[model samples]
Target: MSTPTSTTAWVHKTTIKPTEKFIETLQKQDLPLPTLGPKDVLVRLHAASFNYRDILIPRDQYPFPVNWPLVPMSDGAGEIVAVGPQVKSFAAGDNVMTVFNQEHQAGRHSIVSATSGLGGALHGVLREYAVFPEYGVMKSPKGWTHEQAATLPCAAVTAWNALKDIKAGQSVLVQGTGGVSLFALQFAKAMGAFVVATTSSKAKEEQVKALGADVVINYNETPKWGEVAKKASPRGEGIDVVVEIGGTATLQESFRAVRMEGTIAIIGYRAGPTKDGEKEPGWGEILGSICQMRAIFVGSRAIAEEMVSAIEVAGLKPVVDPKTWTFDEAPQALDWFEQGRHVGKVVIKI
Candidate 1:
């Protein structure tokens, strides 16, 4: 392919209203191509997926600060249209997906890697072309669509980190039907573990069951569904790992569900649909639960590659929401996702 000098992009812009309130929006524009470094590659993005953080960054509502007026959307897949001289892992026409964190090539998470995330610390892939260091991307799974590969970077990688060290016959508990939870259910089952899933919708409960969940509980009908999950585990000991995403609202119940000294992977902050909001329990309650709670901010590039290999081996398919949007409809798609209208990932085809 000929080298391109310009590309179409959707920039995340934050404007201050006269009332001192902030408005978040995506502005479409023809932008100059990214500057290529000796070890960088230029990707022509085909598809990208949305994450909850994408909704917060533009609004300046994300807890972590971000660069404004940047090309947004971290999870993306495409072909390498060009590469710098030192780029070796990939070449022109190679299919690849963006790494969630540019500096996190392998091993454990660190302060540098944690903050070097694409779309947050670096320019992301919501454009016709983008550039990244050679370590910032990897080849997509064989025969996977750009949309399908796009869904893995954030939600799937986070789920994979949450279930690290999972052994066969272990008990894993997932909350709700969000992207991370559903992926956790599928991954845990693939690892030969028993999965206990919780959801408010009867429709979603059936879907979760079909994903090979050993037990499915309705949190609305059973507010204390955590105890139920505990009892449903092997030998009724409790969950070995809890993919905790509900934040303060669901923390208490998660404590109840995890086994003694089990791991609670704090993944997301979406609250449950409840009147007057849910209560956040005190540390005493957490101490009583005796569970280990730690935040896993997605995963490194090495982790992502490992996940793709496992996915190919298991033939696992990610669940993308049926309702999708065109590239021009990005802002509208974010709004729909913010309103919690979809059960799985809401993607945009570029």
Candidate 2:
């Protein structure tokens, strides 16, 4: 394969605060490719996936400051079209996916790794062609399509990251039907854990149970869902892992659901922001539970490779929403995602 002259990419010049719409802020233009660094690989992207944070960036609601006029997406899959002289692991025509935190190769998350996140601190992956450090890309799963592999970089990896140390016969609790929650449920079941899930929709409860949820609690109907999840846990013990996505609104229930010394991997704040006079509830509830809470940023590149190997061996498939958008429909796709109707990862084909 030969290198392309230019790539088509979407850049958000400013936040939606000005235009209050994505079509106005997001612009697609063809531009000349950058000179590939010695360790870089030039790739022709095939697909990209959406996450909660991606929508927040354009709304100026993300926690981090996005560099203006930046390409904006965290997860992507493609095939290498050209490799720089020093590139070794990948060459022309290798299928691969982009890493979410490009600079964080291994070990644990640090200030630097957290700061180097793609789609936020750095230029992101939603483009026709992109150049990444050799370390920033990893091989796609053996038999998966570009679209399937595309969903892994953000939601899949973050779920896997949060699900570490899950063991057979243990119990895991996943909340709602979002991308991360769905992945966590599947992985937890694959790990031989009894999976308990919470969702408001009656239809989603059945769908989640079909996805191997041992028990599905309707959070709206069952206001004390954590207690219900606790009762449903394997051997009737408390949940070993609670993938806590809701921030303030759900913490008390999570405290009720978790076992002593268990982990609550804090992933998202879906319940929205705290009010001016509203005080965040104290941790007084979980004191007896003695649970540990860890904030899960998406993992390092090493973790991505590890996850890909696991998926290949276990044949774990990511759940992508059926309504796929073409490259030109990115703006509309974002609108659809912001509406919160999809059950699985929303993907756009490049």
Candidate 3:
């Protein structure tokens, strides 16, 4: 196959405001293909997945600084169209997915090693063609669709990192029906754990149950749902793990819901900012929980490879929202994601 000379991309020009229109900040551009380095492989992206973080990119809400005219998306899967002379692990026609952190291959993460994250400090995978170091991408899981493979990079990897050590029979509490939470539900069930999920929507309670959740709680109905969750645990010992995605708004509840010496994986702050005049949970409460609190920043490529192997072995499929958008409808996809109406993942077909 012949390589294209130019490809289209959605470029974020300035910091977006919550009140401002999302499409206004991002504009389409047809640019020359990026130059390939000695250890690079140019991929022709077939599909890209959206995360909550993708919406934050335009607003510059991500923890990292923005790279101007950024192609803003972390999860994408495609076929390798060309490879540099020094590239040996990948070749033409290899199907692969981009990694969230391009530099952190393995081991513990560091500020320096984590700086090269896609869609933040570095250019992301939104473009039709992107050049990546061979180490930055991994082969997609066997027998998976491009869209399914696309969802693995960010949400799936984060979920895998959170539940890598969880054994069967343990109880886990996952908040919301977002990508990470849904993936957590699936992964925890695969590990034989009892899953308890929280969603504000009563309509989604059955949906969460269908996803193998042993119990579902409507946090809106039960504002202090933590006590209820604790009671639902085996012998009322509290949960073994809490996928804490709500930050200050929900940390207090997590502390209340988790058992002694349990694990809390801090993933995202989708619960919005802390309300004015609202007090955060005191340190005494946090310390009293005595749980292992670890911050998750996606994960390494090695972990992604392991997750993909598990997916292939278990025949696990990502829960993609039925509403898919074309490349031209990228803006709509983002709008839908921002509305927070869909379950699982929202994908863009390239």
Ranking by TM-score: 3, 2, 1
Ranking by lDDT: 3, 2, 1
Steric collisions counted per model:
0, 0, 0
Among these predictions, the greatest TM-score belongs to: 3
Summarize candidate 1's per-residue lDDT along 3-28 as a digit string, tens digits: 88889988866532333322244678
In terms of lDDT, the best-performing candidate is 3
Off by over 4 Å in 3: 276-278
Summarize candidate 3's per-residue lDDT along 58-164 as a digit string, tens digits. 86678876778788898999999999999999989999999899998998898865888888888887789998899999999998889999999999999999999
**Candidate 2 local lDDT, 1-350, one digit each (tens):** 45687889988876777446676667898777888999999989999999999888888778865687778998999999889999989989899998898878999877778888778888887899988899888999998999999999888888999987888998899999999999999888888988889998899888898899988889889977878888888766689999998887787788889988999999998767654655554757667788899898888888888888888888889888889999998988887888889988999999
In angstroms, the error of model 3 at 19 is 1.6
Q: For model 1, where is the 10-residue window of minimal lDDT?
A: 15-24
Report, for every candidate in turn, its global Cα lDDT versus the true structure.
Answer: 0.85, 0.86, 0.89
> Looking at candidate 3, what is the lDDT of residue 191?
94
